[model samples]
Target: MKSTDIFLEILGCPSEEMHEPVNAGYICPYTSDRCSKRGHGTNDPFPVCSIWKYTGARENRRKDRPVIVCPKRFYTADIVGDILEHVWVGPYERNKINAVREIKMGKIGNVDMVVCDTSNLPALDNFVSVELQAIDITGTVSDVYTSHLSQTDLIRSPKYNFNTANVHKRYLTQLIKKGYFHSTWRKKIVAVIQDVLFESIRERVRFAATNPKDENTSIVFMSYTLDPTETDEEGYYRLKLKEVVGTEHSVLMNAVVYETPPSKDLFVAAIKRQL
Candidate 1:
């Protein structure tokens, strides 16, 4: 591990200016509450929105790549608000649409949020379920976090790897299942994810969503990339929407089930190397 392996891209609320986490806490832009998500064994909220990784010369000479680690990182702006325009259906005004957070359907797993058509008072139908997913880290970085917050140099560098495959194996399955479930209800499901995470899916999963306006599109993915050069008045980097993919529930199912497999001997060759 090297000292440059990890960089905290965001410490507190992504919308606010960077500040020390010792005295006061920064309110989570998503929750509008004290940042509740924490690292292991820490009482106070561990407000790490995202991180930048520097892989050694083998991967690249040296390049800084940002990866969002927290779902709240997607909340610097109303993602669903933007999603509404992309996936909106019916005659209701987009402004009148309400974004509902955290609704659990029996055995379907909890949805992070859903966009509702609030035009009809006391009724919340024609809703679209939304899920926010970030990458799961493969290695520990708490030690790195402690040092960064303390404003001290690392005693020893800690390396962390993004578990992109984990997303494909577990998370994508859940998303497809949820997508199918929503399709049964004749509704739409949207997944908000980072660009890097989506790239991993593009590698392993076959997806070809041509038009967003297609009524057949029951599953929508809106991917964003962190814009380093652009920032709000508070100096927090902007999450620019990079791409939107629209597909049917059945399309997603077939894509995942029929993903192109690698050459048969590729794994065996690697095993031979070990032998």
Candidate 2:
């Protein structure tokens, strides 16, 4: 029933002053301070931590799900605990989890975060990699944000579409390449994302059937959703763990690197039409 919502917070600041500067404070659980990210062309912080998807393609409006646009929003929930249960971290208990951010691997590239057993530090052999991703938005939500700041109603919903294509073209390879490397050490890498993203991925690519419990598995996917019914003292909905599944390097390999192509005749027919 609800539609067109802009979810922004000034942390401990009163709800009435949300549109104004966060005079009281603006602390992020991840950064333990104000959100590190700043909006383009302005020093003002990007106000959208998340938003309710009201207007979009017919298929996208099925549930009016809460879209997690910021990576830090994932930090509000117990995502680490959820990952620990499935990752193949050797002897890394909850207390021993030493999370290092943006650690660079030689050629494979920088991983989002690496969870390690501090007890096994120096060597750092006992660890699992982590990649936290929120879907990239196509159009700017600045219009909606401005409207909220003015406390004026919006005449129309601007295009704030989620860039689902990145799931295949951009992020998929990062997972496969890194997942394969982690597999070599007999460790698992976790892909942390929201439900909307995971659903879009599965629809586009075929997933290989595998269990996270299986020692051979290399990739783990942890999907989450916001619980519309539950809210904290701040009145923001609580994020709940919805599902966790694991796959292997090969499963992800098939996602983009290798795929079945259309028949040659079909290609020729399309070329003929263009000619």
Candidate 3:
């Protein structure tokens, strides 16, 4: 089916076949901006809302424009599957989370959806276990990251959160500490520390959390390489971090760090890399 049709379905709204605009189908003249906002205050007859505006944008825009919607069914299943099947990597998930706020303020980005899951979280005793399980799976990295850290307060405010407890150096210091995860960089590298130096992975992961409630929440991170030939084994997938921003401190930060691996094929060479 067409993407618009799918989007309408995911939203649980009537398709155009209903022969009426979404606003027409509902009672009261709810403008697109007055219906979709999250959270609430004293009920207003019509305070500008977030959800209403988004849905209205979809339902009220020019029909002749190129279809910007993904197949609606994409929303029904786990987001990780869709990411692997579609969407390019690099800050896409982070961008989606940020875009939500932008939408509320009438600012928009290319991000289409925001995802969350609880399996990607790191435990105080077994952070590597979470990381290994995540590496083994093939779904949306953002979903997996959210799942693992579901219990952590960081998820509440991704914009400001990191694995490290400190906010001032949340992104940069922690990035250096994680070795970029699966990367080959030197100098207490952050992300690849799990793969490169397993002994301190726990400390590094925690150091990256911006506001770690328990020792289990992970600061969302990923790794990638610019060399097309670097491949998975060579540590091409870069690390990224995510959390909600403003309300509680979660913020998705992608700093585009550069790292030169000691060896090109580091992560791939480990036969027993499994968690």
The residue-by-residue lDDT of candidate 3 on 1-275, one tens digit each, is 12222122112232222222233432222123323321123232211100100222334733221111112211222234333222222332332221111111022222233332223334211111111100111111232122222322222311111122232243334333332331221111112111112222333333233322222223332221111122233222212222210101122122223223357467666644764
lDDT string, candidate 1, 1-275, tens digits: 32224554645433123436544555676576777767877787777777775666665645567788888778775586677677777777857877778899779779998888777878777888889999878877888767766556778756678888888888888888898888788788888999888888887788777566576778888999987667776666788888888888788789889877788799899999999
Candidate 1: how many backbone clashes? 0
Question: In terms of TM-score, how similar is model 2 to the real structure?
Answer: 0.83
In order of TM-score, best first, we have 1, 2, 3
- Pitting candidate 1 against candidate 3, the one with the higher lDDT is 1
Whole-model lDDT values for every prediction: 0.75, 0.71, 0.23
lDDT leaderboard ranking: 1, 2, 3
Off by over 4 Å in 1: 1-5, 13-19, 41-44, 56-61, 266-275
RMSD of each: 3.2, 3.6, 21.9
Q: Residue 170 deviation, candidate 3, in Å? A: 24
How many clashes would you count in candidate 2? 0
The number of clashing residue pairs in each candidate reads: 0, 0, 69
Error of 3 at 20 (Å): 8.7
**Superposed Cα deviation of residue 68, candidate 2 (Å):** 0.8
